[model samples]
Target: MFDPTAFDNIKFMIQAEVYDRDLAGLFHVHSRKDLVDLATLSRESVITFSLKDSADLRVSLVVKADLEKLAGELLPSSNALPGVSLHILYFGTERSLMAERMDLLEWMWGTERRYERKKIDSDQTGTTYEWHVYFERIITEEMMDELGDLISFIGESLRTVTETE
Candidate 1:
């Protein structure tokens, strides 16, 4: 399950640079009011309603040369970066049911051989077959965790095979 509240406090930083004065002409068709309106709606506080509509969301411009000075105190370089990618495979009983419930498909069809019991009448019963199939991939924390473990297992298996050879 994906939780929207996990990112409630996260703040995103964006910086843009325009090289030439002629580039400023590109916005000639858009009035200053249009730019202000767009920016007002895009601000984190405004979009999330963290603050009132009157709150200031204006960003102060900094010269490229000044960025180095600011970076020395505010940002630090990292020696190593973490590399991780997650892949999820979702499974459901029926294609139509999965599509209706989550808009996904059934994957690895006809794998399970188990049969389930279903009631046909008060004195009789019937057997029903079911298989877990997945059509789409969903990215979430739980799925990522499972993917990480699966990847680790595959990596270890490959390493062992190569070492023996």
Candidate 2:
């Protein structure tokens, strides 16, 4: 049986290169107070943390049981175990930029994008796009060993790409 507490605490890290350094400048243009206000107004779910070197940005998503509904379909009925799902999302300055990067990553991993939508800022009228890649599987005793490594490998691969680019 999977520990619910452990699952609740699990956070996945995703890293991507910021090809255009000017994006960082955009953040600088606004004051800290203004930026906070913008973020509050924007209400973006994905929070970005940039490296000092300006090479890449890291985004973290906490695994939530409520968001695992789709994964539940793949669970075996014989067991009472709850299913876990992995969600990967990408955001960019432009809609096309986000879509193109998602396409390349999905192709490289052989995974299809699941939920995709444009998030419009109600107050500012600005737009941001999100592409969600989901993997669903039932947790099993034997699968536990390989599962950790698989997750780690995914995180490392993303980080490696950011480092190399």
Candidate 3:
């Protein structure tokens, strides 16, 4: 379960970096109060926005520098060094990939051995699933707290995950 409210916190930080040029710089977000160690966020501006469910979004960001290494691989045009603006497109690619893999795995391992409620109903309706992912800001308070825990865990710890059928 992913809380949509908690998403605001993450999306805000990202959007702030993209639209506001002055917001560009090296920043390290830490948990509890550990200025002792940090990771410097690369210096550059970033733009981000969410779109309607049915609408496809195509966007671009321009910056002052010609060296474009920081701008991401959005365009083939060589960019200025120490690039002024870096653009990252978030078109539900992450959530989609996660959903896709979950579907494939469940499909491959028919709903027999790993038994549950004796039935699994696949539907286009969003309300039917026990666990769901959303790009929209629709979350509960408990889920928000859970999200915080997940962030802290993921932020400070790094681990490798290997998937096998």
Name the best candidate (by lDDT).
2
Highest TM-score: give the candidate number.
2
Off by over 4 Å in 2: 1-58, 66-78, 112-122, 139-165
lDDT of predicted model 2: 0.39
* Residue 4, candidate 3: C-alpha displacement in angstroms: 16
Q: What tens-digit string does per-residue lDDT give for candidate 2 at 34-150? A: 111243322112324333343233333323343233234345443345433445554434433355555565665674435554444545756655545566653333344554554
Which whole-number lDDT from 0 to 100 does residue 127 have in model 1? 27
> How much lDDT does each candidate structure score?
0.22, 0.39, 0.28
TM-score of 2: 0.45
Clashes (N, CA, C under 3 Å) per candidate: 4, 0, 9
Write down the worst ten-residue block by lDDT for model 2. 27-36
**How big is the RMSD of model 2?**
10.3
- Per-residue alpha-carbon lDDT of candidate 3 for residues 1-165, written as tens digits (9 for 90 to 100): 743222234334433443332233222221111111124433322332222121222122211122233233234564522223222221222333244434543454345424121122446533221212222222222343343443223222111101312
Error of 3 at 66 (Å): 35
Show the colliding residue pairs in model 2. Answer: none
Q: For model 2, what is the error of residue 60's alpha carbon versus the real structure, in angstroms, after optimal superposition?
A: 3.5
Q: How large is the C-alpha RMSD of every model relative to the true structure?
A: 22.1, 10.3, 19.9
Please give, for residues 1-165, the per-residue lDDT of candidate 1 as tens digits: 743321121111101111111144311111111112243322121111001121111111111112232233234573322121122222122321223222111221233322122222223432222222222322223333343344334233223322331
The TM-score values for the models, in the order shown, are 0.18, 0.45, 0.18
